[model samples]
Target: MSTFFSDWYYLSIRSIKQIWRPLLALIPSLFIPIFFFVVNSSSLDAFSKVPGFPPSITYRDFIAPTALFTAVFFSSGNAGIELVQDISNGYFKKLLIMPISRLTIILGRLTEVAVQAVMQGTIVVVLLLLVGVRIQTGVLGLLAIFAMLMIFAMAWSCVSMISALRTQNARLVQSLFVVVFPFLYLTTSQAPMPLLPPTFRLIASYNPVTYIIEGVRALVLTGWGNPAIWQGFLVATTLFVIMVTLTLGSFKKALR
Candidate 1:
């Protein structure tokens, strides 16, 4: 088991080296969301006054978690694009020809991607604080926030890798956000579920992102616990299982 872990660790380092440059290419991705946060943070007062939401929380605090999560989501999803690129370049084939366990190859790549996800989340957190978003949960609350983001990042990275494994297409990996971003926006990004349009309210209730927003809000704000934390946890767990299963199966078939 130790040997297995060591091999996976080394392979993860290898993947990091291979993918670092392309990952750096994504520095430009933060600008748009930061711009959104600025524009929306300023408009949040009017929006909160627009109705239905509890009056105590500022719109900046309300929408901050979604922006943080978006950073993780995009970073994790894009981190896996190199997996498809490596496969196309026959790097995966070379790894397969080596004596290492196949699972290690996947796990190593995933570990590297997951680390990147946490970095992505941290960057957003820093940005949020820079723009005056505060987490009143103190030390414990801050820990919880980071823990949740990292767990979500791990789960999300696996899903991204699964997408790459299934299609082996960089375009498909890139396009995953097209589907995810719209859902995220339509959900609780702007307000609580009650303030959303009735159609969007129903959809947001079902959205996994809703749970994340709720969980984060519950931690950051003083008294806004939505029972949806369990739902987010469940969705993250389910996606992890489904993604890892499919990715391993695809890896197996690719080797065969």
Candidate 2:
């Protein structure tokens, strides 16, 4: 047990060092969402309070999860860059040649990325709180938001790493964000799916991101419960399994 943990610890530290640049690149990522929170939120609050909708919802509460999801979406998608670098620079090859367990290398890299995602999510949440986004569930609710983001990050990171290994094309992986973000925002994050048009509602209903947003929204918005929260988690777990299996298979192939 100790040996296994020791291996994980070593690989985890190495991953943190290796991906320091990408992690540090989160500066703009940290603030851009806050900018949106300030701007659109001001407009949204005023408009939502009109006679029909009375969008009394605060700007901070409404947009906070979206920012958190954006962080997860972009971070997970871009995680491939680190893997691409590792492969191109031959660091991945050297790691593979070591006596370490293959799974440890993969999990350690994933753990490191997950840690980074949680940190980014926490910062965004704090920013939201500072801006007066009240969490009805208090600290526990806040933790739930972080937990959901972490799960999404973990599952998506697995897929991102697999894509990194298979394609080894940083551009292709980077393009994933453009695809993912639109799908994510089109869901319940920006607005409730029920209010969307028929086709969009259908799409949002089945969208995994919708589930994630709903899960976070449930905790954030209060009284917004849905069974799909659990469903979203199941879907994420299934995706994690498929991605990890593919990644491990590919790792063996690459080593051969």
Candidate 3:
């Protein structure tokens, strides 16, 4: 047990360092979300006053989660890219042959994602605040947002890592990630659910990201007692379990 944890600790440290070592690679994850936030918030500033939109919240406040999440989701892909790089450079196989337990490698990479999520969330939060966004749920709500995204990032990264493990193609893995990002806009991102077109609303209903974003929107604009608040955490937790199971299964196959 001690060995397992110690191995996780060391491996996690290594994985965490690899992410920070590339400044250029990390810049887009940091800037793109802020750019998204600034553009969307400004262009749609008038929409917050539109009927059926949530009251007492600007478009900037309503969309903060999407921006924060953009940072987290995009950065999570780096884990898979790094894993593929390790495989290509022969480092991954070396780790596989080491005395450390194999599962630690995945867990270590997840730790790095979790750390990156928290860091990215913090930066985005600070930037949002600088531009006058406030969380209705206050400090506690902000902390919960961080915790949720950190878990979500770890869970989401598993898919990317699995993709890398299967194709060993960084471009394919990244391309798929980019393709799926538009799904975020399909949700209640630009306007409240009531203001959305019926067809789009129906689509958003089945989208788990809708619930996650609503949960975050609740934290930002409505505070607790909003039933939708717990929905995001539930979805994130469920995804974490499913994705981790698949990742472990995939990891086993990669060994053979």
- Predicted structure with the largest lDDT when compared to the true one: 3
Q: Write model 1 residue lDDT over 1-256, tens digit each, in one string.
A: 8988999989889877754676556675565567777788886667766667778778888778777777666666655687888789998789889888877877787676667666666778888888788887766776676666666666677766777777788888888877767767777877887777789888888877777767777777752354555556566667667766677777755555
Model 3 over residues 105-190: C-alpha lDDT tens digits? Answer: 89999999998888888888889889888888999999888877777788888989898888788898777676547668788867
Q: Where in model 2 is the C-alpha error above 4 Å?
A: 22-24, 50-56, 223-229
Which residue pairs in candidate 3 have backbone atoms (N, alpha carbon, C) closer than 3 angstroms, thus clashing?
A: none
lDDT of 3 at 55: 75
Clashes of each: 0, 2, 0
Best by TM-score: 3
When 1 and 3 are scored with lDDT, the better candidate is 3
What C-alpha root-mean-square deviation, in Å, does candidate 1 show against the real structure? 2.4
- Candidate 1 lDDT trough over 10 residues, lowest sum: 222-231
CA lDDT of every candidate: 0.72, 0.72, 0.84
lDDT of 3 at 169: 87
Q: Estimate each model's TM-score.
A: 0.87, 0.87, 0.94
Alpha-carbon shift of residue 121 in model 3 (angstroms)? 1.2
